[model samples]
Target: MTAVLNAKTVNYYPANAGWTNMWTAFDPVRINTDLAKAAALGADTVRVIVFPQTFGYPTPSATYTARLAQFIGLADTNGLDVKLTLFDWWSNYTDIDNSVIWALSVLHPYVDDPRVITVELKNEISPGDATAMAWARQLIPAIRATLPAMPLTLTVDGTSGAPGLTSLKSQLATTPPDYYDFHFYGPSERSLAEIRRAQAAVAPAPLVIGETGLSTVSTSEGEQGAYLARVYRAAQVAGIGSVAPWTFNDFAAGAIPANSSVSTQPAQYKYGLHRTDGTAKFAATVVNGAWTSATTPNSILNLGFEAPTANSPWRQYLPQAGAAAITTDLPRTGLQSARFTGTTRTGSGLPSLLTSPITPVQAGQSWHAEAFARGAAATGITELALSWFDINGAWISQHTSNRLPTGTTTWTLLTVDAVAPAGAAGVQLHLKSGDNTGTVWFDDVALT
Candidate 1:
């Protein structure tokens, strides 16, 4: 039997403009630009929200249908598939027949189109609304009758463990979905465990992480990148069918409707991978980097700190009294390695230079890290450390390698064996110098 879903592809949620504004504005140029960006970021599929009222109730207008067709064509040209989510921002349980009309009008033309992967009946009907659930039970079968070959599903509002899922589960007994989809907005460790439980709970039906992300207000740009990398890695490791993050670009101040649900919340506008000015965020690098690694095994970018490009992934962190720089002298394996030379000690913490975040391994998974280092008349200890972070980019724990004695003229190898803790989501290789006078050269780092 053919598989019901494609587990190998990574999908994304693209909101070039805020949800309340995208459909009404319907600017083809903006939509195409966002779709192109999504494709560049390794997204094979994008989830789009279509409002019922805007499309015309009872039956959609011919102009709206043509607009949708144009949008789909644009997405296809960009090498991206579309998951059209119907009946967003609408709540009229008594008008179930109108919803069916809307679905048929929009989906009938795309029934045989390979670019249309799936259809979500409703955005997120409240679990407590028995009336809405009843309407859904009636509408799902009706839509299925009209488009029998199309894959169908519904999105639950909350996390896997939330009460809404319990209600959704009960409703699914009568109105079954081809895939069990849900939203998540929390730390990566919690999301990982929750996804597993959700998969078990909705057995047989494929599970997809429909929406997840961190807003800039709650985290820094670097942390946003780190968080996305961590959660995305967890989903890949767990074998999830797909993952669609919140958005593609931060909505400009005037893009949202004044009365819309997210209008008052500034954080919602900052969830985009790119700023409103069209500048790419650090998270974009993290996502694109993860995609490259997945397609090419053991393909670590900038492995030897050799990239001279601006916004290079490698970053250095030091206390008030420490300093670090990339040097070409005394190379370990490449033309250059990182060099640290400082005498003043802050006694705050271990001063070190760190690498770009790596996709995290599972808990209890054995991993090894290796680096070569040499100290020049140093009076302090030099060591290598591996640090772990949760999905929110919060530090979990760290493990340091055996310290190399100062004043070692010849290059020496430093290695550490570690197992990821229960909630680890991302890892960083660190070359640290103790609080004292020393000059350390580090290079040829590898982790596996």
Candidate 2:
């Protein structure tokens, strides 16, 4: 009724688990503990996803169904209501008839459930895909007719922005769901603007920022807080009815399936307001700070490459197939720098070192990268760069900074500013030298 003041996405996955395996490997103890964490974060409602592969599609399995029920029960225990996100990581739009069967089969038990607050027909529906739209068209009214008392909504993926919501609202004009969900992965400085745009796209109907959060991939924990505060604060200022952040806890290393589309993405593991150890990040301090007093960002992670022994979050591209080591040979500001030797391979196979990923970047956001470097007769194309990735974790483009000074030079402060191209969700500071000979020394790299 009132503005949906406190909500969070329990993008729940335990250590070394993800959508592909979380359901089968569901742990009530882990979830019970985690949902309590959510409540402690000041969320009165939580959003969670159900994947078909693990949830038993077409006919929902008793095992995973009970698992889902237990999850809701745990939310209730935590004094929180639930918003169920359906068909996550599912793309089967061919069977409309069975889609109805699957939808009813899974939602039937929750028809009168008090803990269940909302239903998202599909997570990030593809507006451009006719088949998917047809599925939603039939499922939306079918579910609504059966569960008239409940609120129903679906969303366009962030890559589409507000225009995607406009397109979906146009296509599903006749049988639209109760409200619209908007997943935001945009410039935090423009968060309110983006929310306003989505509200305009889905006007006359209520709008919710279903998912928004900053990843610690590209920035420090403090930056993540500052960035995320901007989102929540803007949502409040924009009078958004509800706001569910992307996650509760960060994924542990190697937690995701290697075959998943997001495995290569470093940002995937770091969206959580809490760490895998159940410790809160600086972002946690301000997740609800937009509506409270704890708005100041506190960072404990080393953003600059100035950690003691050259390994905080910095890692080589492919260690088995790459080259790297800590070197005091050249210290910019700290006691060490990361030394990377160029590889014989070139192009996509080019070897280099990369900082952990930074995320939630939208088109035109300025990302500045700087590093001090000196080369040992470095041959070939040795350089520093800002690599960009789309919302789907696909590598979109890269902007190379000035090449590191070649042929035995002093540590030169190499810097460049990059504009995030259209649809970029993440960025990383990269130090590479494709087809390079000898070695390059780098230290004090920073990206923001």
Candidate 3:
């Protein structure tokens, strides 16, 4: 399998009213600037969704093909690998007909462009179950028959576990695609870890953390940086191939359609690497650091294998080596706390906690690894392991648990406060028990 690892792509949405809502590649100056800035940020790829409303619907087939060519021509000139998304009209209000796919078929030449790496069918299809697979089974092969060797990818809203990936796979008679993708919002670690497990349970196609980022209106930029570092580390260790964060720039007035709900939300203006006024956000620096340096100690870990169900709207590049660790400023607002009653499972086709994200504390950086641990019966838990992958891409294990005098429910919060291993860039926090059956509660893990 080929791993596309030249730094994940970033989204660029210009604030100018003219280019918003409509993506006209014919506008040379505007397209050039967007591509130039993306390449400057070490990005080798770019993703854009063609929603029905943005690009005319019930439009003439010939006209649609012409538009698709314009987009392809633009990407080729920009020297970027592209992940082109088709039929990205999210929400229930809009109506999309089969003509959209027919239009793509008519404009089939663009789908085969060298600059285009994968052609995504949709974005974040909810309840991505059998029905979705049936839809994909009908769609993917049809596209492949025309485009032959081009990779086809599907993106889901959340981790594969949310809607039961196993069942989705059972419904599909064909093997999963080249890669599976998903998104992670918050309780960031928990959501990421779940994605890793889901990948492991599925076959070994490359995995991708297709989308992740802190919401502009609700989270801090600093927290976003911290989460990006953590998530990247986890993804690397998990052997995930690649990751693409939410977007590259601040929102603009005409970025989306006039009636678009996203255009009305505050999050529409934020969730970018740069602020609305052409200013850079702190998270951008952290994301850049992780992307450019492969051996930079404390780098984010990428993780696992597993195919996403068909028709799902998320796709990501899986990390190599093992599972991935994803850190994000996006907070898990209302998700209830989870308590571990028994140890997690491990086996082929079964879930396993294979990777641990490490966040190294630097001299000036105020960072701590805090989590709750408990003991069962009267036996002390030994071999409690916490592994950290340093800047050099080497995995180092650290133990954070001591002997416990157990009996009742005893919770101990272990905090490690230290300077990031001199010149360290990232670290993962892990906890493993020897022979314990007690619940452990972990929350609000942060490094600022």
lDDT of 2 by residue, 15-59 (tens): 546666667677878888887877777777878788776777788
- lDDT by residue (1-448, candidate 1, tens digit) is 0222542133332344466466666788877887787788787777777887778877887878888898889989998777888888889888877777777888999878888888888887776788888888898889888778778888777543445665686876887877767677765434565666667667776777777777886556655665666567667767874666677777777677777867799898888778888888877777676655543122233557675533334555654657667789878876888787874556556677765334545578787888888888876768888888765577899988988786756788899999988887556777787565768888887778
Q: Candidate 2: global Cα-lDDT?
A: 0.73
Q: Over the stretch 1-448, how does candidate 3's per-residue lDDT look in tens digits?
A: 2634333766554555322254543355665677676676667787766655556554634555566566556656776777777666634223233643553554376554577777666676543444556566676666776776777666666544534444444444384555666666543433334456557645565567777776656655655655666667666766775778777777766665566566777776777777657566766766677777743233222111111211111112121211212222211222322223344333321111223344323323444545444443423242223334443445544435343345544555555654444433334444333233443322233232
| Minimal lDDT window, size 10, model 3 | 304-313
Better of 1 and 2 by TM-score: 1
TM-scores, all candidates, are 0.73, 0.66, 0.62
Candidate 1 scores a C-alpha RMSD against the true structure in Å of 5.0
- Candidate 2, pairs of clashing residues: 4-241, 16-255, 217-357, 217-358, 218-357, 218-358
User: What TM-score does prediction 2 earn?
Assistant: 0.66
As a TM-score, model 3 comes out at: 0.62
RMSD of each: 5.0, 7.7, 14.1
